[model samples]
Target: MLTRKQHELLTFIQTRLESSGISPSFEEMKEALDLKSKSGVHRLISALEERGFIRRLANRARALEVIREPDTASPRTAPRGPAPVKPVAPAPATLREPANDVIEIPLHGRIAAGAPIEAMEGATMLPVPAALLGPGEHYALEVSGDSMIDAGILDGDMALIRRTDVARDGEIVVALVRGEEATLKYLRREKGMVRLDPANAAYDPQFYTPGEVQVQGKLAGLLRRYH
Candidate 1:
């Protein structure tokens, strides 16, 4: 049996993971639970792990796996009045269809622009304006560097992307280069060379062959929040 707090934590983690493909960070978890210290969060996590409700990936930040979903059923309660009332019948379950006006885009962690960082997932969902969404599947990635600052995409901004394996020349795209690293840059092919062009002058453009670069997604829009 899990405590109320433990159950709430587990439910939050499971809901976040199912929505975003990424797990929430320690700070996020702490905030969600209204805890004053990260140690408190760690203790709750440890308890959940010990009970086989969740697992943590070693050495990975925000790496969490939910082995079991939290029980959503509420416990039965005794009669509060005089205990002379008749038995009450439970209401019928109703199916809820997902809202169509708004779409929940998965935030797949951060993508480096100045330098390639192995992208991480299990991030939270961002409900974006439907008009800003383009064709095909859409997802969001937090930009982590200033390489694309000249294009108005700065560090800590979210890059909305439409999933596609192909990109036109001069289109800003998320490209997987050399099957190892991924970067956000303009995709341009000229003279049989594929160039990952950065918007900022401080960084030099990276050049590769068509076989070395794979298009992951093209930029659809950008979302920034001023703190």
Candidate 2:
């Protein structure tokens, strides 16, 4: 038997995975459950996992799989309201088995590897090996400068970025500053300020308030073409 919130979350996840091949983010789950914060969603997810209802995919951001659905007929499921709707059957195995193939992801224009620059949006698409990506939405950015050369991210290399709004400290991320300019740098938090660190010693780190810096994605892999 599962709690009402648990059942609702599982159903929502299953529905999303069936329609779109990716799992919902923690923010989406929090909003769907009408919860106060993402912590609440974390607790619910942990509970579900402990009961063998779901499994988190390893090495993948925001990835989840519904291992088994709760028994809907149990008296403890709803207790008062109408019986819970049975979850739709899991998607076919063939639909979820292309993790090792090639796929095209949106290729957003160049991102700054030196100074902050506008990350232009366009209709370009980048063909990427699926093995380079994990279980989340992804996009590509063309590197434009040498600030990240020390990180082995050279000029003109294709940066494979996984689309996500949250990242941990010291991780290389694409950060949007003041909702306008975007740059690729290491993310750090210090004294209530967000720090964007460069991999090269020639440049200084940039700092902004927490609200000014928005995480767009993290570096998943790099694609370089030899001349």
Candidate 3:
């Protein structure tokens, strides 16, 4: 029998996997369980693993495999081996692959690294590898400036954006300024202001009140075409 907290955590993990087809990150699980720290989530996951309820793969972030669901009638048995490790998308230049599991995302036109451009929505779909994208809803944006050049993002590059409204400090984000303008920049939240810092030093950082800034999406991967 599972404890109340364990049951809740397992249910959350199973639900996320069914809905998004990916394991929830530690931060995500922590938030869902209303825990103060990821350590609490880690402990619960460890307990579940030892009880043959879940399997955690080594050397991978968010590499969790839910072997069985709570309230199921099957007997609890330990996983035979480690989970397969797959290459994940990092916040840098991406490598090309032959063919893999592809998912389609909406191409939302271009975003500005130099000047803030109007975000446009279209009916086109962009195919990207599922392994690189992980899970959750995603979209693509064509970059159109040089302010983020130092961050391996250049003009004409296609940025794979995981749809999100919340971003941690130092994360590259699509921030909507004053509810109208949107720009791609490194996000930092001060006591009362939201700072959008450019990767290149030539440009100055822009700041606004917290209420004036809204995060649209976060950088997940980048697609560049070599001429």
Per-residue lDDT tens digits for candidate 3, residues 101-178, read 345678888889987777655647776654455445678899999999999999999998988999899999998887
Best by lDDT: 2
By TM-score rank, best first, the candidates go: 3, 2, 1
- For residues 1-227, what per-residue lDDT tens digits would candidate 1 score against the true structure? 66767877877887777666566666678889998855456667767778777776544445567876533543122234221212222212232222323346778888988887766457787877543553357789999999999999999998999889998899999998888778899999889999999999999999898999889899999989999
What is candidate 2's CA lDDT for residue 57?
68
lDDT of each: 0.74, 0.80, 0.74
Please give the TM-score that candidate 1 achieves against the real structure.
0.54
In model 2, where do residues sit more than 4 Å from their true spots? 1-100
Model 1 error, position 191 (Å) = 2.2
Candidate 3: Cα lDDT at 174: 92
lDDT of 3 at 177: 80
Give the clash count for each candidate. Answer: 5, 0, 0
